[model samples]
Structures are given as structure tokens and as C-alpha cells.
Target: MLLLNNHTMKSKIEKSTFIVKLTAVLVVLMISIISCNKELTDRKDFSNNTGGNVIDAQQQKVLYVIVDGARGESVFKSSTPNLSKMIKNGMFTINAVSDENGLSATSWADMLTGVDKTKHKVISEDFSNNKLTDYPMFFKRVKDNTSLRTAAFSISPALSTKLVTHADVNTSLPNDEAVKTATLAELANNNAAVVLAEFQGVDKAGAQYGYDASVPQYAAAITNIDTYIGELNTAIKARPNFSKENWLIVIASNKGGDYPVIPALMDQTLYSKPLLNGFVILYNPNFKSTIYNKPANLNSLPYLGSYGKLNGDTIASVDAAKSNLYNFGTTGEYTVEFKLKVQSFGTLNAPIFFKTSSPANAATGWWIIHNGSNGTWRLGGLASAAISTPTTKAMEVNQWYNIGFKIYFVGTVRYVQLYQDGDPIGSPTVITGRTVNNSEPLVAGYRSGFGNSATQFITDIRIFNAAVPDAVIKDFACQVLLDSRHPNYNNLIGYWPALDGAGTLIKDQSKSKNDFVFQKSTQWLSFEDYDNKFCIKPTPELYKIVPRGIDIPRFILGWLNINATGFNLDGKVWTPIYTNILK
Candidate 1:
């Protein structure tokens, strides 16, 4: 009986061991199946299917609209239903600012060329020199792509000559009615890669009649423009080709005009009111969050990032750095902050200061900041160190820092704070009894003195109309330290007026001097018959005939040489170079 019981126990133990081994095998098989399924799903989503039709590159198109003089503030007040709807549905830049030059021709030229006026050498309406004419105009660079059609219509006479002379297609009609017709016709063609439209009657009227008299005309023009813009939007929506993956439309204003003057003048000189110039708005439907993930090796040095529009031909690093300097307005409180990554601490004790360009008094509208004599940050309105802290902590190299200020009621201010890696430095110090003056341009990246420079990586820099809440400020600092995205960062780079097929930077070569040359060429000469004697002259006027034997640059020639490799517009990359530049 004892032997029988031992055998039964042994058999049960073996069965239990077998059951445990089987369970382990099943678990491993389930995990393997899940892992394979995940890999397959990812491949299916991104991989190009062999049976699907490949999209031809020539079918891509972009619409770019530049309103000659529209203020960021006035966009909401202007009763532009179409623009407002687009802004809400797509993307809108609330604090979009333009560069220094307020002139339409200069600003538009910068927009089209992406090169500074100094490079393009086209500054104002009176500019007649064709020295830079041969440089490939923006459209000329992409015109050869057979699938890519290009056209531009401008209501401003200031732009008419330049457009006809430089653009790939001169489609400007005499009046607003003609502009609508041409714009619609281009839309119907379905082959165009880019279409640029400019409206300037309001600007002309504003310049002629005073701001008040021109208000109605401006309002009327905006209404008409809104109607047409809506029509275009509707037409594009109706087309099968108009998908998020295929088409993009950009709407923006070249600059803002100044009217209803406000006492507060912060960087108003760039586009002062009664003429407020530098307001620009952008809308892109295809934008994704990844666009702001600062591209690898994107130089963070001042002026190395996207250079804003500024005066002068060649904008040096200093000029680029100086572009962000702004002043406090007369009435409201203003705040400015810089997100910088420092490398090493130098002998410079006072790394930051604020002061006016001139002595702070009742009248001047400019102010500046710099290092103070007492080893502290100084406020422009106050004589002594407004915020004092020991400079004992060694500055960490390649780490982000935040320099912020809160200015109350013109010059009556609170305190400024400096944070290194999200922690406030030492203590919060205060300043008392100072008048707000706007005599000097506000500056950063150096001491209060002229040209006290520093090499730092700056990003997500911002200026606010109201004092930033401490909680929001802390979150901002934390995000910067963690390398997280902020609303303002999106406002800075992602909300561009236009974008390429990849939904990255604006694809229009016009924004950069990609295909155009700014040098003199016979092809750019304007001809006139003086008493039946035809004479060619270098002028801003348009030429009807293409000049023969014009010397094309090596880069352009290289593009032309490769035009036969199924790479030219006809094969895939629809562009206008053959018709506009090569001709």
C-alpha cells in the first residue's frame, strides 16, 4: 500500500511541472506576436505602397498674399471675415513684427528675395539701377518646371515696374477687377506652383488723403480683398488636388501703417504709427508641431537664425542682434525676456543693464539696459544699481539663462530678474522714483554701453504687453531647461506665412536670393524709342523682348544642365526658371 501511494504522488508532480513549462512558452509567443504586429503597423503607415499612385511634384502649388499696409492690431478690427476665419481655422501670429525699413518696395523686395535690400539693391520706387537685375528673380528660379505655373498681380504702381521686370509672369491688370480676373484664371489653370497677389490701393489712398479720409477706402478695399480671398479659398477646397498633403496658401501684410497715435512707442521707428509699418500675419494649414523642433546644427548665434527684415543692404551680426531691441511705451507696462544659453563667465561683472539712449527725462521714447558700476544690473530710468546680486556663482557654459524685466506705467517700474538654469539669482532688488523715457533703443546680449558684446545661444526670446505671471514664468523657465516647446516658440517659427511641401520653412525661393542675381545684364535693360531711334537704358521699366546671349551664372547653368535629367519642371520639379531666367 505504501509503494502505491508514492507512485501516485510522483505522477501528479510530473504533470504539474509540465503544465508550468507550457504556460511559459505561451507567454513568450504572445509577446513576440505583439512586437511583430507593432512593427508591421508602423511600416504600413509610412511606407510607400507599390500599387498606389505616386504624386508628381509638378502638381504642387502655393498661393502667397501680401497686404501692403496692414497692422497686426487692425486685423481684428478691419472686418475681414475671410482673413479672420482663416486666422482662427489655420494659424495666426498675434505679435508678428516686420523689420526696420517701413517702405513697401523695400519690405516687399526683402519678402520676395529673402535677401536684404543691400544684396538685391532695390530699395525704393525711385530705384532705377539694374545692376542686380540679372540675379535670378524669385520666380525665375522655379519657372522651368513644366508642371509649375507662376503668376503675380499687384495693385500698387510701386510694385508694377519691379514685378514686370523681375517676376516670372507679369499678370498685373489695370484695376482691382482685373486683379480678381487674373487671380481666378491662375487658380483655374491648375498647373501653377505659386501665385503671389499684392493689394496697395489703400496704401496709396492713405498716403494721399490723411489717415481719416483714407479709412473708408481702406475698409472698402479690405472688404473686396476678403471676398476674393474667400472665393479662392472655396475654389481650392472644391478641387481634388487641394489636400493637406498637396496645397498651401499664405496670407500676410508687408507692413502696418500708423494712425490713432499711441504714446507708447516700442520699436515704432521700424514702422511708426500714423504709419505703423512692420506688422506681418501668416497662415499655413499644413503646419505640424515637429516644424519647431530646432533643426540639427541650426546655428543659434545672433543673426545666424532666421534674420528678420532690417534696413541697410548687408545686415551684420550686430545689426541682426540689435533688431530685437525694443522700448517701453508711455502708458502701459512692458516686459522683455531673453532665453540665453551661456558658455563661460568673463571679467564682465554686470552682464545686463537697461537705460535710455539719451538721459531719461520726460520726453525721450527710447531706453537701454547695461552693466552698472556697482557690479549689478542697472535700469535706464534709475541712476544706481536697480538689481544688485553678488556675481560669485561661476556662469555655466552651454546652459540656458533667462533675463526678464517688468516695467510699470512708462518708467515707473518694479524689478528685473536674472535666472540661470531656472533658479533666481541671489535676491529680488527694487528701484524707486524714475521717469519713463523712450529716448534710447532697448538692447540686450551686451552691457548698457555701446558694443559690449557677448556670444550666447538665444531662443524663445519674448516681449509681453502685460507682466507675465510668476507661475507662467516658472513654467517658461522649466520648459526652456527641459528643451520643451512653448506657445511663443510656435509663434516665432512655426507660424510662417508660407511653407514648402514638407511643411517646413517657406519654400518660395523668392524669400532667398536662390536663383536671382543682382548684377547688371543686357537682359534687364529697358528700351525706349526716342523719335523712332530705339535706345536701351538701365531703368526700372519692363522690357518686352528677351535679350540674347546673356551670361548665366554657373549655379544657374548647372541647374539648366541638369534640366534634362527628369529633374527639371517638365519631369518632376515644376519650376519657372526656363521661361523667366533662361530665356
Candidate 2:
């Protein structure tokens, strides 16, 4: 049986005490999660991102819904018309992970902190075990930075008191209907920037009967919650200034239930919640219902990939015109980055990067040339090139790598630091020549290298005037926040995203004069497919119990009818699976 939340067991008991006092312990834990965690001693108001005096931008708001014990399978399989509509019009992933600890407390901790139970330290219901100081909740992150108001509403009293922290308004009520009413009332009163709402009846019913939807009480609970969800949606849309407010409605489940056993021998309790990756959806009118999925042949490392693909044909070049963009004057401290995959080092693969006195003469040019005598990356020169000391793991071909080069000068000697996929390669190369001249054009792709080491794709190419630290370079390798949004953007001289898939002029996102010209269009082509890069998506949980066809009222013509907008979950035209259109 799988363990939930990856928490360490306190030495397996000869037998569990669950059968004796399960109800009492569960009730206690639930109450503790809601009311027990103490206030962090070092709590501070979130730092302001902007002044209150400035005309506020079109406000963004969130209606965060936590549906307890609503297994991933029940969402689409059972009748959740409202949720189904939201999934169709927004971004959703049924693969959101719950902490391996399987308890409501563990799941709640992760939901708040965006961390595993180990980091949040909420393995059980003991609030004293919470380490919110280090791993603060997302609500705190929101409240601290923006002028936007935030609130938390929950049917469980302890949730608003114990689990939730730092909100402008918080209300704990008795039931789902009450919570929904309060949320709606608040929306009408003042447009709260954020509202985190929780419904507990589903879990309460699951505990009373069985969590599987086949169990009448559990399915009934789910149906009732769907009704409340519809009401909440109506309230959100019915607000006076709804059009001006961009609302993000998110629905997520905590732990799963113990119904619909996958296999008889699998110890359903331990495996149930862990197997369910859980359901989560971010619904917004502007959201394109695209679901990101991992590639079939994905490696362990995940990347958001470049802004677009940079097709590297041997003939093209991105010449940084003499705008002094690439010139690392006298101090000679600069960093250049590229996520690249070399197809083949043909007969003459000499230079991958160059800024020289001239192209033909070898007098002075800074080069990170590929294909040295040892096939090791090196600082290129005519003869005395300093190759990487030696690496058992040299640059492999055909695989993508985030390569960074830091060049600096001390006295007359030039120092070159090589970072292959964010790690320092071998040792820093010490070269004697320092090309202090800012005369030559900064040329990429068509270098005077020995062989034709054509780049298959060059994405996220960034050049900085100052030497960037190894830590920042490592961090940037995995992040795709892009040029201006990047923490190091101000110093970033040139950033050419070759991933637009359909561009002749490679736009320099850094807004510098350095842009590239496409020569022989047929030789290279930008590819927009993300299937090549590893996807960052939740794990899919696909087990559920669907009740028999009850033929419940579908609300075909009224506001309850999801098809009134004719939008499918993928935002395609709504079409019933069966031939009968008048279902």
C-alpha cells in the first residue's frame, strides 16, 4: 500500500487503533486543522507593490473553492454539471497532488503553503507542528503585496480560525448553504480581491456512508455541493461590476475518499487518496482551456521551454549591430546564455559565439568555440585554445542543454568560466588574450569554427553586459519568465527568443538594437510544438464510482444550462456524445 504525504510512519503499529476511536480522532484532527495553528511570531504585513493613490488597474479577484474528499474520478464521471462547465471554459488538471500523508490536515497544509507536508510540517492536526514561518501560505503572499482585500469563508469553523491566516475578512459558518450565502453577500457588499471558500459536507457524508459515489449518501452530498457551486457562480456573475472584475474561480479537492477500490488487496485507505491526484481547475473567461501534459519521452528535468523555437540553419546569423550591446569594454565582465541542441559538428565547427577585431584575421575575437581536438568546449583561439580540463560527462549531442559562458578580465589575462546545463564545467579556462576593442559585430550562428556544428535549436539566448552570478544563471536555466520580467532584465543587453516559430526578424525582447536577419528562409524553420519539452502537469488520478443514470433535471433552457454559451470544456462548440441532441 502507498503512503500519503511521504510522511515517515512512527514505526508501524502491530495494529491500527483506527477501528476503535477513528471518529473521535478524525473529528479532533479536523477541528485542529481549522483552529489550532498559532500565529507566526514574525508575521508582517505584505510589502506593497504599488501606491493606493494610483488609479487601480482593472481588479483581479479569485473565488477559491476547496471541495473536501471529492475524488478526481467523481468530478467528470459523476454529475457535476457546474464544475464540468467551469472545466470546459478554463484550465484544469485532475492530476493535482495531495500530500502523501492522506489526512485532511496534510492536504490542507499543502493547499495553503504550496509545499509538501514535510516542509509545511503539518503531518497530522497538531497546529504547533506547523512551520508557516518558513513556508508561508499563498494568501499571505497576496495580502502582503497588493492593496486588494482578501477573505476566507468556510463551513468548518476551525478552517477560518486555525488554518487560514492574514485575510481582510474571515467568516466561519454552519453549512454549505450558509457559506455560499455569505460569499455571495460579500461579493455584493464589496468586491473582495480574493475569497477562499471551503465545503465540508462531502467529506462528512463520505465518513457517514462510504466515499464512493455508488454510495447513495456520498453521491447525494456531491450533488448538493454542485448546487451550491452553481449558486456561488451565479452570485459571482451577478455582481454589479462583474464585467470589470477579472475573476479566477478555482476548484480543488483535498484528499480523496475510500470508495471504488482499485484492487481488493491494495489497502484502499492508504492507497485511495494518494492514487487520486485530485481535481483542480482555474476558471477565467480569458483562460484558454489548454491542459499541459508531460512529453512521452520526458527526462527528469522539466522546463517551460523558450518563448518559441529558434531554428538554427547553418546560413543565418543574429548580428548585434555595433550598438555596443555585446562590447564588454575594459573590465571585460559579461555573460551569455543559450538553450541549444547541436545536430552535428560538421567538417568545420569553429565558433558558436564571436566578437572579434575582424572575421578573417585571428588577431582578437572572444569565442566559445565547439569541437576542440578533444571535442571538449573551450575558449577558441587559433592554436593555444584553453579546452575544458576534462569531464567524464562531456557535452552530449542531440540533447538540449542550458549553456552559460561568463567572460571576465584581470590584468592582461582573460578568464572564461563555462557552465554546461548550469553546472561549472571542469575548471575556469585561463587565456592570455583579452580583446578590449568594441569594433567587431557580435555575430551568432555563422562563426569561423573548424566544422559545421549546426545548432538544431537555439532558444532563450541572453547576453548581459555584466558577469551574472552562477546562481542566477542556474536559476534562469529552468525559468521562462522572459527578458523584461526576468530578475536580471535591466542588465540583460540582448535577448533573442527564437521560438516564435514564424518570424523572419528575430525580435530582441530586451528592446536593444540587436536583432537578427533571416537568410535562406527554407534552411531553418521555427517550431512551436511544446511536446518536445517536458511538461509540468499534475499526476492523473483516474479511479471513481459513477451512480446509475438518474435522469436528474438538466436545466436545459435556464441560466443553469451550461450549453447556453455553447462552450465545451476545451472551449469548442458544445456537442452531446449521443446522437440525440435533445438529451
Candidate 3:
């Protein structure tokens, strides 16, 4: 299945590219014909230029229903006849979480765009903070393809205005009833093919009362919404052509309650994932409620050794003088690398790894910090010393990333470049501040004197006096690193392979023998790559998905390297697809 091998992939992309250009020509001719001498019928053609240029019917149209702050437990166990029936008859997941942490804006944007906050650039609720033009919603996607698509958005007035750009009908109302009423009108009167109806009552309940099942207001909110869900389903079934049309009803929540994922982390108890704990229900006539169990392929690594466990500020402490970080002189040319798996982000701005004596005194030191304001990695440190060319997105929990930095000097101008999986994030960045040369023990995991605690698993740490070559880094990111016997091992100042789970100390394999012994006095857990593996298949067929109207079969996008010239502006699907209605 996959055309992943270089030869077949290249040729397929070329073929698809040509087909898209040819179809664009066909679409244009059809459009010209439709424009001239179109019978000016009295029927309100809700059709706009934004409607899909290549209109055709797919197996099903979508009705996206979102209930804010509805927890999985509340929704699944609530006494709701209609939702219960739908769940029993539908393909659903009760353990689903918002794609990003439970932030409403980021969650909805990601769901709508089928991408993450990194791609969509929506970190918060403010519409101005979004970059939706580059990453658009699915409705806009359908509309761009053909006019056979008609969409309606019945949403909360206070929250979203930018979600709809090409929809034929957009309504904003005060309450769920008003939103339901508008949605009903669209379903009954208008031939809208796709719809999004969002209600915020459950979230309001959680914000007002508590998020637990025992909370009366929260329970009441769920009960009331269940009634409204029944009404909406009834309206859809009552459609004139309901028998002919295939409809897919999707019910999901953006997030759960306001409780922080990790209130005050300590031990493994302090560790918690970014789980939103919401439900997803997909209902259609031809579907049965079933669950698929598979390995967690959240982009993991082959576990080679026991990871460094840090609870509170407790580190695998080496004597101050023995630290490679401490012994390095004024020369800033070196590479520090580790395979990192974030189990918990204790508090915002807590350091993952830093060599500085104090965070405030970080004017002379460098850090790889979590910048919460933007939910991204801050490569430089303090103020002007950090990378100026915009940082990359923050690390997601429960995934493995080979993260590190190359601190090198150019004519005494210190530049520290950040790398993930061997590629540069921005550019070779400059850190104007020089190292303070402190005996901070080259702190890994959590730094000292930080109130907020964090949980992480790190291994295969290497502080090379010379930067590791890009090829070596890329090929062996998760593999066993260079040892003392290797030719290039002399460049290494400190190397902790973290091999062998049972040990009194983590040995520095690269000649120095500066090992750190256990101080926490507990079980040394073996390394296991507990990463979440989603969409890990190499088969190209698995990635195929036709945009609603595109006549061409869904083809692999990533491996084939098909450009947007063969697709819509966002490269979602091949555009100018063959269809008669475009004209």
C-alpha cells in the first residue's frame, strides 16, 4: 500500500498535479456556461460564488453538534433517552479529549480545521489571535469545492463570529433554545447540506456550580441538553428528503471541568496528562457501535534505558565540579541532547532543563523553557538572549521528542540553536548573554528553587564539546549514542546512556565516569515508550479521503508530495474537480 518509496511517490504527485490543472479548465468552461442565460428562477438559490466549484453527492453530509464543558461521565451516564439510543447505535468514544488541552478556542479550532494549535495558531479565545485564513474550517472547505454544498452555523453570539465565512446562513442567538430554533428552520426550510450547532449551557453550569456528577446544576444542564438533542434529531428525521440523503450526526465536547490536570505534582501522583475527558458520538444508519483497540502509537521511541524521573526539584545529582555543564569554560560551542517524554507540565514557565544558578539570574545562562503565553518552546532565555525568530509549538505530553540545543560561538557572538529530531526549529539563534559558569550540577528534569514541580523521563543525555553532526543526530536520535570507545567520543564532555534499569548510579559512558547516584530511594522503573501512536500507518491508502465534491479518488497527500496547485488553497483536497454544477 503506500507509495512511500521515492520513485512511485514522485510520479504519482506529478500525475495528480496534471489532473488537477486539467480539471480546473473543465470547471472554468462549465462556470462560463452557467453564468450566461441562467434562467432567473424565483427560487432563492442560496448558492454563492463560495459554494463548491465541483459539486457532487458523497455518502453522507455532516451535522456537527458541540456541547461545551460536557464531561464524558456526565454525558454517558445521564438519563437521556435520545443520546443514549444514538450512543448505542453509533460509533463513539467516551474517553476522547479535546485535541489540545481543554482550551475552548484551541479545541474548537483544531476540531474544525482537522489540525492542531501549532498549525492553526489559535492559542486562546480572541479571534484576532487566530490564523484561520491559512488554516480554514471544513465548511469553507466544502464551499470552495462546489455550489451543491449549503452550510448553516447556529452558534453562541458571545463566542464565535469568524467560524463562518462561506456559509449561506449564519445565526447567533441567546440560548440553546434559540440556537435550536434557528437550526430547525435551516433543516426544515433550507436544503443546507452541512450544519454546526453549538450550545454552551453545560460549560456555564460547570463554571457556576461544580464539574462533578453530584453537582445538581451540572447534572441539570446535561438533562436539559438531552431533551434538546432529541428535538434536533427529530427535526433532521423530519426532513422532506431524509430517506434519500445520508446524514452523519457528530456529538462531541471541547473539554471537561476547570480542574487543572496537575494541581500540585509530587511523585508519579504529580504526573498527569493533558486529557480533556470528553465523549465523541458519531451516528449514522449504516454504522454499529464498536470500539477498536490498538497500541498507543503517539509517536514513540524504542526504549533503550530507564528514564530520569524527577519529582519536585530532585535531580540525579552529580557533584558540582563533576558536571560537564559546570566545567565548560567561556567557549559556548557544544551540543546538549536528550530524549524527552513529558509526563506532566507542573507549572507554566517551569524549566525542563537549565544550567543557570537561578531563573532571575539567567542573564548569563540559557534555558529551554515552556512559554505558556503562546504554548510554544522558548529556546533562548531571560530577555534578548532568546531566539528572536519566533519559537516552535510546545511539547505535547506522552510523546517522545529528541530535543536539544547547539550552543556555538561566532566571533565571540554566542548563538544557541534549538533542534527537535535533528532539524532546526527556527534558525541558529543567538544568545547574547554568556554563561555565568556556576556549579548548578547541570540540572535536568526540574530545576532547583522552583515552587512548581514537573514530571519527565529523559535518557541518552550527551553534552558534546563539539556539536553532533546533523546526519548523526537525524539517524540516531533514539538509538544508543556515541560511547567512549568510538572515534568521536573524545568530543563528549558528559554522556549518560541511562542503560540497565537496575543501578545505584547512571554512568557517564563517555570516559568522564561522572555518574549520578539515586537520592530519592525508590523503585527504578524500566524504560517503556508509552507514546500515543495515532495515524502511524505507512500505507498510502489509509490516508485517502476525498473532499465532499472532488470526483477524483482520495489519494495520499503527504507521501505523494502533492502541492496546493493540485488542491484548494489549504491543500486539503484536489480542487477544480470535475463537476457539472460549477457552471
Segments of candidate 1 deviating more than 4 angstroms: 1-58, 89-91, 144-147, 164-168, 208-217, 240-245, 265-284, 288-583
Among these predicted structures, which one has the highest TM-score? Answer: 2
lDDT tens digits, residues 1-583, model 1?
Answer: 8999999999999999989999899999999997677544422111112222223332345677676666555555566788766654343442333434456665566565444455666666564563245443446545543435567887776575664443457665676667767777777765655777877655655555434333777666666767878887876776656652345466666666657655554321222343433233333343221111111221121211231211112111212223233444334444555544443333333233233443233323323333423223333343244443446643455443455555443245454454443456665444344435433433333433343334433334455555555556566653321123443332221111111222112221211211111111111111111211111122211110111001111112222221222212111111111111100
Predicted model with the maximum lDDT: 3
Clashes of each: 57, 25, 19
Give the poorly placed runs of model 2, Cα more than 4 Å off. Answer: 1-174, 177-313, 318-320, 357-361, 372-375, 381-393, 409-414, 430-433, 436-438, 447-455, 479-487, 522-575
Lowest lDDT sum, 10 consecutive residues, model 3, at: 548-557
CA lDDT, every model vs. true structure = 0.43, 0.58, 0.59
